[model samples]
Target: MGSRDLHQGATMTAMSGATIHQVAKAAGVSPSTVSNFLNGRPGRMLPETRARVEEAIRHLGYRPNRAARQLRTGRVQVVGLVVPSVANPFWGAFALHLEGAALAAGYHVLLCNSARDPERERAYIDELWADGIRGVVLCSSLPSLDHVLPLVEQGLNLVAFDRTAQAGDPSRMVNISVDNVIGAQLATRHLLELGHRRIAFVSGALRSVNRRERFRGFRDALENAGLSPDDAIVWSGAADEPYGDLDVAGLGRRAAADLMRGDDPPTAIVAINDMCALGVSAGVRDAGLRVGQDVSVVGFDDIVLADLAAPPLTTVRQPMADMAAAAFTHLRECVESDEPATGRSLLMRPELVVRGSTGPVPPPR
Candidate 1:
């Protein structure tokens, strides 16, 4: 049978009172054309045929069922977004931008929290797929991405953010991130320029690509200046802990306290993120030391509360909106394309925002 004849035969019986086939038969066109027209799919149809389909739909009072359409297509008009923690200020800001961008593009975003757990991330991925989510933007920082890659290979469009390089196959996934190394260098450079030689680095997880890159930047700046940055490093011991399970602020506070216990405490501190920096600042005050004057503190991410802290925060600012826009655009391209996006890594620049938290090193007693 001819293509049109086949469509007519397959759609002959009306599953619904006003089925797509009836409209196609009335309009003297194929059922696929009618389906396309009703679904707002863009295509060139003869003016008379278009008019006929419209009139037939009106005459038959046909209403397309979105649920049935989704089932037929095996997809939904939405995408999934997985983040380490929705409660983290940085992730929260990112989620808002992502949701806004998705909405602007006529798509909905289903936000899921991985809590930095592999199992939870795995489950969420499966659940999202079962819900007909064809695309996902993942911002996980776990040590392994074993669970995620298999799904992508199964035809899921994935955009990796924050810790993109860890996904193993950049060829099959869209990767987007800020130059965390530059951000850390900026923070460390600011402290060094302030004549703070004995600076302390407080960090949470090293497994996260962002954290590792930031640390590398920190070392690069110090080594470039002929200083030993390794002597200043202090792990927060939260590397293996899931997000929200360990209080990063408390980790900062404890790290600051431990550093102060030394006979020669650091003249300045650099925190992995703004939340930890705030904790470090509080720790300094609790130890009868001034922020800025006694010991300067610098942070990364420049979150909203960074400025509202006691001394405010001198930090590196990630371009959340720009990154979100780029990631959304990439994912949408992958979703719409017949070929997958490959081997492209977009690294955005971060700026240094000097606030009240950093200053010249204090005079020794």
Candidate 2:
């Protein structure tokens, strides 16, 4: 094209909003060279030259079309994240951080929620592979790693968090997680220190490694303190304790009439998560028991509800932000590494935050 034509074309493209071509020109480099630089692939280019392209793309606010970018560079610049049950606030926030990190690095993200279903997890895994993507960050694991093993064999980069054991290879995957066992132990130890005996453990699906670890810590505290954890004291739930409370509320004037009359009542309860603990709190109120006065509670995952609950929850605080950042860092390494390096798992220590929800155990009746 002539100078005038080149000028007109540039104007038209600019008017439409800057894309890869504009992004490249603004950086004074060939479009292919810019694509290589952005994708973190080696090209016969200098560091200073690459920096110019990167700076220009940032200054111009350029976003490349996903399709064209993929065609020019083998990398789709898409990080596929498979999370378990976005309904959980923990998973939801983690997904947001993963996407944000990818975006800041001038890439896009494809998020898929497995909803704790193995079948759906397999399906999403198959589809992301078929779609020809850069890599994946698998948040949770299923009973079978058949789908995942193949991805590794096919030379697809993969990293996992929270469920690294199920990934089948520590050297091939990175993990970002809380020290679940320690976190739980910390929460449980606090209650033991407060002299709570006959404490009940409320847990979610036992399949969750994190929850299981939390339960283990709770059990250890009871054992370490010379208290036998009555197997019956543990409640594995799907309906949640709150639903039992809802049923109680439905009883209207009769609510609290049958409080703990069914069997021996504990002075405090330990919950696997904030949601389950919230349910336990509801049950406590529905039964006319004064939480933190008549009974105390401890929860894990110090979610927002941990602080907002009527009796603010004393719980374990997983370093969600730091974990998120670590997950992103691990993922970027997987994305940018020339070839797979031996994978590493990193666990952040959890902190126990004592709030109004827990207190010294009430005197024996």
Candidate 3:
């Protein structure tokens, strides 16, 4: 039959509830062949047969009954992905890459935004576990993993992203992240090399593991330069706020304005991320100061917009695609393996990308 005729047939069959047997008959193949296609075991099947089955499925809009499949196989073809906030483009980009990897492996991603709240993270994970999702990629980077320890102990295949493995973490847990400390150090050292002595570190909160590490790296860089770490300015007015993710850019802008108003304003600012860096750049203009000339600004996470900024931000680059692929690969291995889970941490290196937003310490203003 022609494609249109097959689609019409499928519509009628779907209205009456299509089944594997019906699909097999429509494809002129045995039900076992259809089963093999659904189960991802069609490698041995002839190319034409596989194509026929795929076409039949597409024309029929056939969706496998996941409930029945799970009942029989005790597994679901879906994985959970929990991110801090999609407001930050960094997290959104990471999610896109991660989803791409998941789709290629024949799995779907269920994304949740937790706003860096531990309780919310635990609740979402609980829901995912209850829904038969055995694997998850959590990107909250919370300082402690205690909230979800119970679920992890119960055999949830979890891959923590943007957070380093801690001593108290479960033995089987997988942690994947760019080396935040080194990344921050690279950003700060670049500023120091430009002869910027009065530097400031700007971020929302020093609560999360990654943020804390970045702060430490900033301090380490300052100390390495023979400058007292305490001499560097640190702005985190929103430290007590729970919804900092929603207004990261605003926070950076505010920090910039307040710092520039001071008598000993910093010659350079190291923002938490590119979003905040963009905000800082705006704030610099608000204070009637040129970004690259008056006060250099450096940001972490070389997001797409970093290059599009008015002055083109100089920032640290995370290998987002590679990290996403690694996270998915590790999670899938844990999900499909029959062996006992073993804990592992993957720390990817980051590179510094210089752009127009930073420059030599503006000849002491």
lDDT of each: 0.81, 0.70, 0.88
Alpha-carbon RMSD of each model: 6.8, 5.9, 3.4
Per-residue C-alpha lDDT of model 1 across residues 104-217, encoded as one tens digit per residue: 988899988876778888899999988888888888755466887788878888877876465456358767888988889989999989998998888876766777888889
Q: What is the clash count of model 1?
A: 0
Question: Can you give the TM-score per candidate against the true fold?
Answer: 0.84, 0.78, 0.89
Q: Kindly list the per-residue Cα lDDT of model 3 for residues 133-216, writing each as its tens digit.
A: 889999989878999999989999888899998888887688899999999999999999999999999988777888888888
Residue pairs in steric clash, candidate 3?
A: none
Which residue pairs in model 2 clash with each other? none
Among these predictions, the greatest TM-score belongs to: 3
**Model 2 TM-score, all chains together:** 0.78
Error of 3 at 252 (Å): 0.0
